[model samples]
Target: MKDSIGEKQVKVVIMKKFLIFIFTVFGLFVGWIAFMVYSYERSYNEWKSSYTGKIVTNSEKQFSSSSSSTQNYDYKKYSSSSDGNKDDLESLMNMFMKRLFPPTLLDPDYTYAYEKAKSWSKKHLSQQQIIIYLTKYDRYSEDATQYALNKLNVDWKEQALLRAKSYQEFHYSKNKLVEQLINIDKFTQEEADYAIEHVHFDWKENAVKEAESSSNGGNISKERLLKILVEYRKFTQEEAEYAIEHAKIDWLN
Candidate 1:
């Protein structure tokens, strides 16, 4: 049978148990600090070795071969040098910088962080930014961010379509737009064609807009306006002729 505890003794027992728990927590904290210090020292040595051109082979870990299967973590950071777009270097750095450091307190889950980066890229960033944004945030951990980055369902064709619509705001002709989509934005020929077909803008209005907006040195002539619309704006011969006819400009001496 258990002994019946008196009130005074019960209070004492409770105090002792509380003290034991506090001690356990304190001990764990001390151990964690020790581990952190050791890790720092190890990292310092590795940095020194790298600086001295020593291979960090032992520390190098391979996640997998195909990027489809895993996060394709570059222990060195950033995507492969083989990436086609040389122009993406700027946005890539921006995304990498976000992932450089995580919030100190109230850190969200790895998947949340990864998805946040991906969403940002989808709305307003490049593929380079989306690719490595989360992996670096997790310090290259094999977590949900890594998995999501590796296996995301990105629609490049849709991205092309959105960019085309945005460009139409600036009133670029279909020819110039196709060139931008294919060369600068890095869309395939088929994707560029899709964007051109889907983008809605009045080509005649665009030509007139360009003609009226031209700030020429002398009083602008109708023939010069026609040339401007055709050569610079990439308007078709017929479109240029129509714009010149409709644009009621004071072509004075």
Candidate 2:
């Protein structure tokens, strides 16, 4: 009877060990399945985000293409009126062109638009008109119109230059044309001098204050500021000298 009782106890112990091992295996299998499910969910979310970005990019491209197509059509319609009065036609053309070639289209990638404007100028505009249009359009082709302005012996050249300078003065840096003049390697020293002499720098105190607060102020060098002033046509020889003197004393340190 003692031997039988001992054997029964041994069997009970074996059964309990087997049950614990089965439960442990089951828990591990469940954990592995949960990990796989989480990984799949993460992968799916990433793919969705990528697809969404692609869709947005495509939509923006489509919108730009559509806008360009519409503008081309409008140009044709407005330009086709042969019986239209010259002043009326010019006014209409100017308004339409402004809409067609906004400032955003001035990037190098939009060389096609620049070519189109150049072609239009040659076909339909007088020299003065071409200068006006190109300057207004921000399609200033130095190789093309600037050369023509030099050759034309027209009083309008000064007018065109002044207009271009004025536009650049207002639109380019925050009155940093003097700095730009110094930095640009493209212009000859004589040309830079001419531009500096003619550049309009009706300096406003507010503008100077704004520049002081700008991100460019702390890092901007005296030479660069002088160049910008020259480019902007704002600095007289005396003012330029004074600025140099002041910058050396106040800013260089």
Candidate 3:
């Protein structure tokens, strides 16, 4: 009986050891599978993050390029429109001045109007167009005062005389009229006489001197001088003759 009991106890111990070994092997297999799954998940998350970053960066660069192109296009359009408007304003103003004045009176304000017209023409119209308009209606807009003084040719003499006559009609100083007459050899004796009659006391002596110096011996025609003098409501006939006689000649004349 003692031997049988001892054999049974040894069998029990062997069975316990086999069961423990099987459980240990199963535990190790489970641990290896869990580790493999965790490593794979971590690698997948890293790849997804890298792909997302690339997509975001590409989108931002495209947006920047599109915005820059739009701004350039807008700037060019705005510049072209502004230039066109300025040209239009100039053309309109030029047309308005021509309609307001008659040809004979155009010279007085021509210089001021012409400058404004020129600025407009350069910015808005072609050179050919500007030349054509000026040629067609230039007589009416001619700057008379500037033309008379600057042209200084035989052709300009008539216009200067007319301007002097106009000044006289308005009762401008006789001294002013005399200065203009002295330069004009073509001035009739009547015009000179008229100038003499209106001559201020302060200017009479100077006039006589200027007339004497003239090649004509200051003897401008008496009849012509009388006509101009009569127009001077302020002067008597005797006063006009006395002034003419007293006038002295300059050496240059």
Candidate 4:
């Protein structure tokens, strides 16, 4: 009986020691976690304070105190090495600064819209075209898209001219090209007229090329080709007649 009693006491003592060890280890782990969190927060706070203070000091220096008038400072100081226009560089800097430091901030939506619009502008798309694409296709908010559009310094006339020139390979008529620029590309009527005036192409030759392409199947009648050119391809009746005369096709076959 004495031996059994001593064995029970030994088991109890072993369990107590195990429990104490587990509790001690758990306490230490919790203390380590707390220390890590405290360290990260302290580091972040210090960096943020220092960086923000530096930015403010620089910003104050950038704005002259005497006249209190905003002068166009050389944007090169804030600009990255990338080759972009002055406005684009300024927008980029704005986004970068906003991302790095949080203050009176621009919406993320606006920033994204601005970048998207900038990309479309590089593709020679008109502002109206981009706005339509943003609102209709991308489902961006109109306010955000319009805000982005307002910031851009795009030459709509030049964009229209570039877009018009791109269709030269397709052989479009002047009237048809104007319709395309206005209806399809969303360029203003004035811009479309400017493009048509600037873009050089022979409408009659385009009609001929289009008629020739249509007759490549060798099964289409001349009347069909003429109709297709005039009605479907937007070529004038005279131009279509000229195409039917010039294009080589076996009308009987």
> Which has the greatest lDDT?
4
Tens-digit lDDT track of model 2 for 1-253: 9999999999999999999999999999999778666655655565557657866986687567656578786776468546444544454444444344443343342454355455644342335455555566756664445544444444432433343364453434322453444343233334445555676644443234333433154566666656655455354445554555444223433
Q: Higher-lDDT candidate among 3 and 4?
A: 4
TM-score of every model versus the real structure = 0.46, 0.26, 0.24, 0.54
Candidate 4 residue 177 C-alpha distance from true site, Å: 1.9
Given candidate 1, what's the lDDT at residue 132?
Answer: 52
lDDT (0 to 1) per candidate: 0.64, 0.51, 0.49, 0.79
Rank candidates, lDDT, best first.
4, 1, 2, 3
Highest TM-score scorer: 4
Backbone steric clashes in candidate 2, count: 13
Better-scoring candidate (TM-score), 1 or 4: 4
lDDT over C-alpha atoms for residue 66 of model 1: 44
The ten-residue window of minimal lDDT in model 3 covers 148-157
Q: Which regions of candidate 1 deviate over 4 angstroms? A: 1-113, 124-151, 215-218
Error (Å) of candidate 4 at residue 156 is 0.7
> What clash count goes with each model?
0, 13, 13, 0
lDDT (Cα, 0-100) at 184 in candidate 4: 82
- Pick the winner on TM-score between candidates 1 and 3: 1
TM-score for candidate 4: 0.54
